[model samples]
Target chain A: MAIDWGFALRIAGFGLLLVFSILALLIVITRVVTRFASKKGPEEKEKKEERE
Target chain B: MIDYQTGFTGLTYGHIILICVGLIFIYLAITKKWEPYELLPIGVGLILANMPYTGLLLTPEQAGGVPGVAGLLGIFLEFGLYKYTVLPLLIFLGLGAMTDFGPLLASPKGFVLGAAAQMGIFVAFFGALALGFWGIADFGIKEAACIGIIGGADGPTTIFLTAKLAPELMGITAVAAYSYMAMVAIIQPPIVRALISEKERKIYMKPQLRAVSQREKIIFPIAVMLIVILLVPRAAPLVGMFMFGNLLRESGVVDRLSDTAQGALINTITIVLMLCIGASMSAELVMRPETLMVLGLGLVAFAAGTAGGVLLGKLVSRLSKEPFNPILGAAGVSAVPMAARVAQHIGQKANPRNFLLMHAMGPNVAGVIGSAVIAGVFLGILG
Candidate 1:
């Protein structure tokens, strides 16, 4: 009985950790990409400045 | 010799009760648009299963599920659903085709929320174990694992895993998974609202500036599937079907097959599976006090899972300089866009400018992959 419960918790924790870490990594990548895409140019910012 | 003038009308109360229940399912599908995906087929199958002397459930000759003979659908329940494990796989393939992994690929960090959301799965599993100790369903480690995935709120994954690990509980587990996913629109809004303030909801997301090429879309699924599937073969049945459907979608050549998989195949399978499920819910089998226990534990599991995801969101927000609205954490239950939308809706209500949907999708889709991985891991650990 003790073994069954411990096994359940371990399996559960492993499942949660595996999925959550991957999701967190996906977010970090998206943030990095967002920063990269936004750095396209001062000129792009200037063009928008003119419009505003 | 007896004065029995029976036609299609059911012969006994057991027969009549189940037959009518089946017909009602059909009516709900045709008229109510109530989970048309599975309800229609289930309704039809249920009607067939319930009819007296139709013998939808096969039993030992002496056992009395349908008296003397087995019906056509009974064979399907036995061979097609139980024996071959064909229907759940097909459903997953269709779900994969319908799903767009673009949002997930674009923002991979969303995977964390997906993972965090699965805390609910483990919580649910532990809950099941406790319930088992307290004398719940004939639930063992594997059975508890199957039941716990319901917190993932992913029907295909739940069914796929459970149908393999604990076929006896498929009826309850599948229905619970779908029911929760469907109600996610209703259940999650309050939870999202409770967690985040108005300012957070109104945050606007800048438009996705980069163009996603067709090649990238096609290659991503194949590569990811290869990486994940090769690593965890147990995950292949669910992941493989999902990826194959996605490949079919992105291939741009198999529109016909994709359409059929997404529409016809899914519809047909859903109908059959739902009926097979409802048929499993016979008065003798389902109408027990333990069902309430199952439902109560399900709610607890969902609530705990939501809390876990949101708490992780809070942690991420605290750790990052850029504010990460923890409301998105509640969206991690893999109810797909529904949970994500709730997070978005709640965020907007708090801060009318905050756009949490795209952010939430990261976790939402992550939740999908997360659920699959968790299922794979569970299957692996148990195996």
Candidate 2:
């Protein structure tokens, strides 16, 4: 059977674009969650500062 | 009574060559300590598999209608690898238990570097297709996709993808991936140096990372699972198990379970998985010219991955207001701590006071997730 170059190229393009988009979304979500969790109490802020 | 022949009756040049290859793997494992856990067992398996008429591994005819009389290694390959796909996912569980997402949580930019590094996968994919198109090799889309994942520098991911797309090439791909991972210390430096300038390597970031709270730590895995699975439901098997293992570690309530998952469970699974993978490498299977080509293409993929990560690091460093050492970018190839250590070593060589271990780890861990996500993408499209 002959190899389908076009389909393979499409797989590459779509797979990469999907990976980047999902990871980017993850970064955004993580930042938001961490920010909210930190804002809940000054004790948390103090602990974070101490650790740093 | 005199019909008995020696076990070496059917041995040939192919068997000798494969035996020698197995010996080389053993030598590397013992002397150089190159992924000894994997290579040693794999070496032993290869030796056994190549021994003529040992019946250690069942032939297809033997397995077809045999009842309670199957080759030991054949059983492992069929059940552990092809039939159930259990070992790789279990390994991910251990990896998750062993991993601490603290660094990644502290510096989220590592996620971007991690994603960027997966460019190696696509680059190799394209290369394989081009080779196939030109009749240089017979790499179809499935074969090309499996070969490309070796660049991910994640062993379980490589095995998982290969199992799904090209089980025929499993032994070689696993060997290539682990071998490159073992040599990350050597293969990465020159490429990183070529891509990153001396000043960029010496660029110092503060050592302090924000401490993640227990609550956030507990929530991280759940959040990751929800988002990732929602985005690509096909990732559930690998990513879901990984997150579950992390949750066990971070939950603090399941210490015993977490310890076993990371320690005994993982080690046991590693032995079985590596041995079975090795046993699959019979002379007739791996002695082809295509095997050599796959090995060469695997190297190309790895180098491309490192280059991709380093190049992205340079780009991110240029754009961001904060000083970013481009060398940390090389850590995005997901060889776990080794790749990160290479980044740290390169950084320290440039400047004595510079410490990039923790910084590099951000991307190092992120690379793990990135590779899995890419694996999911491939499975989504191809599987």
Give the 10-residue window scoring lowest on summed lDDT in candidate 1 chain B: B59-68
Tens-place lDDT per residue, model 2, A1-52, is 3778678878888888888898888899788878876434578668979999
Model 1 lDDT tens row, B118-146: 77777778777777787755567887788
Interface RMSD of each: 4.1, 1.7
Query: Tens-digit lDDT track for model 2 on B1-383?
Result: 69877767889888888888889999999999989998999999998889987777884346785776678888788888887789999999999999898888888899989888888888888888778878888888889889999999999999988988899999999998999999999899999988888888888877777788777788889999998988888878889989999999999999999999999999999999998888888888898888888888888888999999999999999998998888888999999999999998999999888888898898998888888888888888889
lDDT of 1 at B325: 81
Give the CA lDDT, 0 to 100, for residue B338 in model 2: 92
Candidate 2 segments whose C-alpha is farther than 4 A from its true place: A39-52, B59-62
Any runs in candidate 1 off by more than 4 Å, and if so which? A1-3, A21-52, B2-33, B43-48, B59-70, B207-210, B321-323
Best candidate, DockQ: 2
Go through the candidates in order and give each one's C-alpha lDDT.
Answer: 0.72, 0.88
Model 2 chain B: which ten-residue window has the lowest total lDDT? B59-68
Please give each candidate's TM-score. 0.83, 0.95
